[model samples]
Target: EAGVAQSPRYKIIEKRQSVAFWCNPISGHATLYWYQQILGQGPKLLIQFQNNGVVDDSQLPKDRFSAERLKGVDSTLKIQPAKLEDSAVYLCASSLATGWAIYFGEGSWLTVV
Candidate 1:
């Protein structure tokens, strides 16, 4: 009945600085995701987690980004040496299954200047 929860509703960092985002998915959900949305664009899947393991991270930019799920409930995403182009909204989403409609959190707005 509840939705996904994300913290630090907004973040501002200079280019090359680091930032982190946290997310807690809805209870009993089996899949979680991290997405990046540039203004006027659809959210791009950064990583996918099924339970406590990674399901897909092919789209993630590993050179500057990392993510992890803890015990299949909580997750965190980090970006080091962030770039100006990293300014965007970071979304956390969850679904009951792989193909289910995902419920998204209010999103973490990042500003890299």
Candidate 2:
């Protein structure tokens, strides 16, 4: 099966800087999510989208992070004024819908200095 695709597999930025990551989910998936995995920690759901509408974003830090799935096929996550503690692997995942098996991309790694 085809897998999720993400760009700029790795990034290094100074604190207070900004960065963005893009993702393309497998075809036909209607549910998409963005997760943050700090070093040595499990991934935490940052936001979720069902088609072009947002399903959940309670865990996302609106003050610094933002995400959108405009057409529902591709998505982007952005962080502004990134902090050192924000360093982590940003994972993009997709599934048929809620409760379905999820497939993850290789992840975009962020290192804030």
Candidate 3:
């Protein structure tokens, strides 16, 4: 089965630094999501997009984090002035439809000192 594609499998930075993660969803998929996973906890949905339009982003920290899915296909997530608590795994996911089986890419690990 085809899955989402993500770049920079891992990243390390100090507090107050900035980083960006990229993602390419499966072809023909219409729903994309970005999730943050902390140690020992389930993934937390940060943003969701449908056909390049944001469907949900209430959990995203707008002050220091931002994401975009252009042309309803590729996406990017950026965090500026990251904090220690922000160290976590960023997951990219996509699916043909909501409520269906969603496939996830290998998470991007972020570590902030």
Candidate 4:
């Protein structure tokens, strides 16, 4: 089984610029999550998806951040007019929908200058 795949691996942007990240979770997994991990902190749940529908997005900043899983297979997260505080590693994880050990991708590290 393939693990989650995220790209660019790293990003550098100026404050208030727009950026987007992509994720491909493990096949057959029913649960997908997007987390923002600041340096030295735990991964914060930005959004969670159950198949094609969103299950939890309360932690996501609606003002500038948004994510979607169109066909329940792949997902994309975007931040418009990025802030300096938004600089962090954006990770994507997948689980068996039962709280099993979630597998994580290498993450896309965004740095806003």
Candidate 5:
């Protein structure tokens, strides 16, 4: 089976700019997640989608970050007015269901100057 796929593998922008990333999860997976991994830190959950419904987004910085999984197939994550601290690797992951074995994408790297 194919693993999760992410696009725009690298991006660079000035502070306060906007950027977006896309993800396509493994086939047959029912759960999708977006995570942020800052340098030297573990991945932090940003948002989670169970099918086309949002499951959790408490950790997402809604002020500037937003995500959606429409049709329960693909997802997109966007950060408007991006901040310097937002520079990191955005990871996309998927699983058969909650608590099931998860697979991850290569990640979209972001750099905010």
Candidate 6:
């Protein structure tokens, strides 16, 4: 079985530039998640989606960050006017909506230059 896929494993941008990252969850998985992990910190859930609908996004900074899941498959996250403090790893994980291990992708590292 193929694993979760993510792109732009590394990115460098100015403090005010906008950036986006993509994610492709595992096949047949019904739950997808986007997390932000700062250096030396644990992953913080940014958004959680069950199929095509959002289940939780309370931790997401809606004023500057946005995310979406399309057709219950791939997803994308974007940061507008990115801030220096936003430098961190964006991790994508997917689960089967049942009792099982959650698989994570190789996170996208954003560096505010």
Per-residue alpha-carbon lDDT of model 3 for 53-93, expressed as tens digits?
99999999999999998888999999998999999999999
- Candidate 5 CA-lDDT value: 0.97
Q: Which candidate achieves the best TM-score against the true structure? A: 5
* Per-model TM-score versus the true fold: 0.97, 0.97, 0.96, 0.97, 0.98, 0.96
Candidates 5 and 6: which is better by TM-score?
5
Candidate 3 Cα deviation (angstroms), residue 8 = 0.6
- Lowest summed lDDT across 10 adjacent residues in model 3 is found at 1-10
Q: In model 6, what is the error at residue 37, expressed in angstroms?
A: 0.4
> What is the alpha-carbon RMSD of candidate 6 to the true structure?
1.0
- The digit string of per-residue lDDT tens for model 4 on 53-94 reads 999999999999999999998999999989999999999999
The parts of candidate 6 lying over 4 Å away from their true place are none
CA-only RMSD, every prediction: 0.7, 0.7, 0.9, 0.8, 0.5, 1.0
Global lDDT scores for all candidate models: 0.96, 0.96, 0.95, 0.94, 0.97, 0.95
Q: Candidate 1 local accuracy as lDDT?
A: 0.96
Better of 2 and 5 by TM-score: 5
- Against the true structure, candidate 5 reaches a TM-score of 0.98
Candidate 5 stretches with Cα past 4 Å from truth are none
Candidate 6: residue pairs that collide: none
lDDT of 6 by residue, 14-108 (tens): 98899999999999999999999999999999999999899999999999999999788999999998999999999999999835678999999
Instruction: Count the clashes in each prediction.
Output: 0, 0, 0, 0, 0, 0
